[model samples]
Target chain A: MASSSQIDLSGTTYCVLTGASQGIGRAIAAQVSKMLGPNSVMLLLARNKEQLSQTASLCESKNVKVFYESIDLSKASLLEMNFALNKSLEGRRVTDFSTSLIFHNVGSLGNLAVDTARMQDVPELREYYDLNVFNVIALNTQFLKLFEEVEDRVVIVNITSLCAIKPMSGMAYYCSGKAAREMYFKVLAEEKKHIRVLNYSPGPVETSMIDYVLAETVNKNLRDVFNSFKNQGTLLKPEMTARKCVKVLLNSKFSPGEHVDYFDDE
Target chain B: MASSSQIDLSGTTYCVLTGASQGIGRAIAAQVSKMLGPNSVMLLLARNKEQLSQTASLCESKNVKVFYESIDLSKASLLEMNFALNKSLEGRRVTDFSTSLIFHNVGSLGNLAVDTARMQDVPELREYYDLNVFNVIALNTQFLKLFEEVEDRVVIVNITSLCAIKPMSGMAYYCSGKAAREMYFKVLAEEKKHIRVLNYSPGPVETSMIDYVLAETVNKNLRDVFNSFKNQGTLLKPEMTARKCVKVLLNSKFSPGEHVDYFDDE
Candidate 1:
């Protein structure tokens, strides 16, 4: 078996990352771009075209090629999504790349004001899962199909959370979405023995999401905890969390489909 | 705190059970109806009206009123569902009952032929979750809202499975759906201190679902294991598992939101 060190991005690699316009996704894109070889290709996906372009520019290098596409995964039909994804590939053969990496990072917090009992809107719930769970599964399937012939190395990362296994008072949708998405990847790991699947929980990071939670969460205790994390400067920076994520990828000591949290010791 | 022994159903009670037309659901309706006191009301919901009526008749008693509603949960709009649910209540005040109970037993196995990689159709995935997760949450929210004023005993039961926490190679949809539904209920338990929430895993049972798995499962290993369970007579009878479910409700020894399996020791 190939060692973890062999997964170095300095080789010819093909990387696809979602929600890459900002936060942890952007950080991962930038940091990984620096490590990728000259022939490597990186495709960034997000709904915000301007932000995606900015992220793409930041990730561009004299060595690696970076491209960004604005695609609203939540609203796109499966057929449309496949077309967009295929267009982004630009006819690149998956077998040509020595390494293939996909970061399933697109997700949402949904409506924090609604507790489990108040979240009765079926359409709203369906839209939330479309973005956070179904789309993730669909896109992962698409990429796995594209990379099926790549015999050497393929790694799929799910940006999971502590809520995937822990229930919060007012965050039912987010928690369930994370749990479902995480379990899907775990099932993939069991089905595909050759692929490496990791559910990386990045802890409480300093992102717009934290701000949103502080402003909207119905659970006073949960809101206070997020506030304290920020006030005490304990909340991690996206870049720092992104570094830890890449380290997990490069280290690769984790069991297949293991949930590796940012606070967990290496 | 009231003792678990005091939760005896020999009182004016309102019970709403989904998927009550057959299998464990039918068995539960039959058993619970027998225990309910005079003036108790039981509402059974399922798509098969004929089967539902059969189950309702089986559950009928001189003292209790049994009603069945045939509604396709997967296709019903939120407004339609609310109307159907309200119609089933027949102007009965939630406060009129001494006890309130809900058994969320409806679920599906989806297409066993599709593995994680093959479950790429977004529409199909959404439809699966609509029946298995979203509608469950919506209906639970509706009932909880109605029972919010019942200052006494109210029990919400989720018919979950081992697959909620365990990943199966080819059953990604079923596993993810169960995990998501279970998490939602867990969140509800955390939010609602007055209500009793229990996730009951019936274990491997002698149902048509088992036959479907044996016939359609893509994973040969999983099929063989299930077949062995059947041939060895290890698969539980629906009536026996229903007895265990009622026992759990009566014992109430489990922590709120705990997943209690049929195989678990009392």
Candidate 2:
């Protein structure tokens, strides 16, 4: 008989990535599509549809499917977000995907200054919690709900910051939010064995947040801190940090629960 | 000369304590009134008006002024809570009091079993955060606002638990909430040098929370853990724990931003 080959590539991987519009999130989107190969679907969530669409196009692959959704993860409740997800996946039959990955890259470094900034700003602090912590818990729980039953592969990658462990002078909201999110993930790590949770610190990168601080921060200490780091050229490239994150995600032998840093990996 | 018996007791000390309806909270109320002397005012807060009134009656002192407010700290915002506080102190210009203290003794160990409980229970989880974390930040900020201008004596006592540092498998909300509150206080301690913030772990004590856990918990492991500690008589009396907390609060030489444990103190 003449040699013949057939390959069925359908519903192999499904990923939900938050804050995938730009910066480290965009870099991760581009790199993850290349790493996961074909027959996969990646859901890019962001509020800026234009930037999200650009990220989707930048991460385009022949066999891998990518779609960006314009949804404010910070404001949406678990029910609303879940409804959105189900609607997005409607009739796609993506449930049979072997590996479900959730990357929480959404964060807000709001008012990066020590001058007159106070935690008493309840609305702003709550907003930080909603974006950096609550959304992740909601989406991670949703993914665990889907994958926990079938005993399939599940992974959670939280883009945590060094501020989580080291408290900043003025960034109380950001620091505590990160700490709370990491603690939640730690508890999840203990609760679920089949699921792997990694709190990854993407090191200092040249993002808009840093640029904003460099340009507009009024706190002399914070300005000097950011300017010093930038002057020293110590900030890692986003692509390099994404590569480190992907490597950590693929390394199965490493134990979960603890935090991993990109600089340490280097 | 004849001794003057008319004691001019005015503007000596003011204290705000949450969860003061019963248990260690009531014990702390009793001891704090005695420690802050006769001119002290203790504003007790709780949801149950009857229980709070009863606790106030039980803590009646000839020296200190004791009053209870029927307000659920979890439901009220910082603004509303501050209004209630000012209303409670109506006509009593106690702002000039030499010492201002805030005791955060409120926390919820809701639905202690992880069986089907998810942080997706946004309302309940938000309640946990409000009662355990944000309220403390708000109240502390208020106190700091009152005392930060001058180098006055201000102390914040957060009634923490081992679960703050030791994450429980089933009590993710409780553990992470405590961690968030502690981190917030840690940040406050660093930002303001005039304030002393202590995350005081009262140790395992006999309280309604334990009784409820012992009575209505589905998690066998958690039940066994609580029962074993109870059976071994390792649990300290609420009064003893309260005394230890008061001792730590009175020690001015001790630095701030420290996690004080009752057992460790002994």
- Measured by DockQ, the strongest candidate is 1
- List, residue by residue over B123-227, the lDDT tens digit for candidate 2: 566666776777677766665665554434566788887777776676677777777887777766766555666789998898888878877766677788889
Docking class of 2: acceptable
lDDT of 1: 0.85
- lDDT by residue (A1-266, candidate 2, tens digit) is 00011111233667788999899999998888886645677889999999999999976787677877888887776776777567656556645676677899998876555433245655566667777777778777776675554434667788998877766666677777888888888777766655667789998888887887677655566677888889999888899899888877665443556688886743
Provide per-model DockQ scores: 0.76, 0.38
Q: Best candidate per lDDT, number?
A: 1
Stretches off by above 4 angstroms in model 1 are: A1-6, A87-89, B1-6, B79-90
CA lDDT of each prediction against the hidden true structure: 0.85, 0.72
Question: How many clashes show up in model 2?
Answer: 0
Question: Top TM-score: which candidate number?
Answer: 1
Error of 2 at A74 (Å): 2.1
Q: What share of the true interface contacts does each candidate keep?
A: 0.83, 0.46
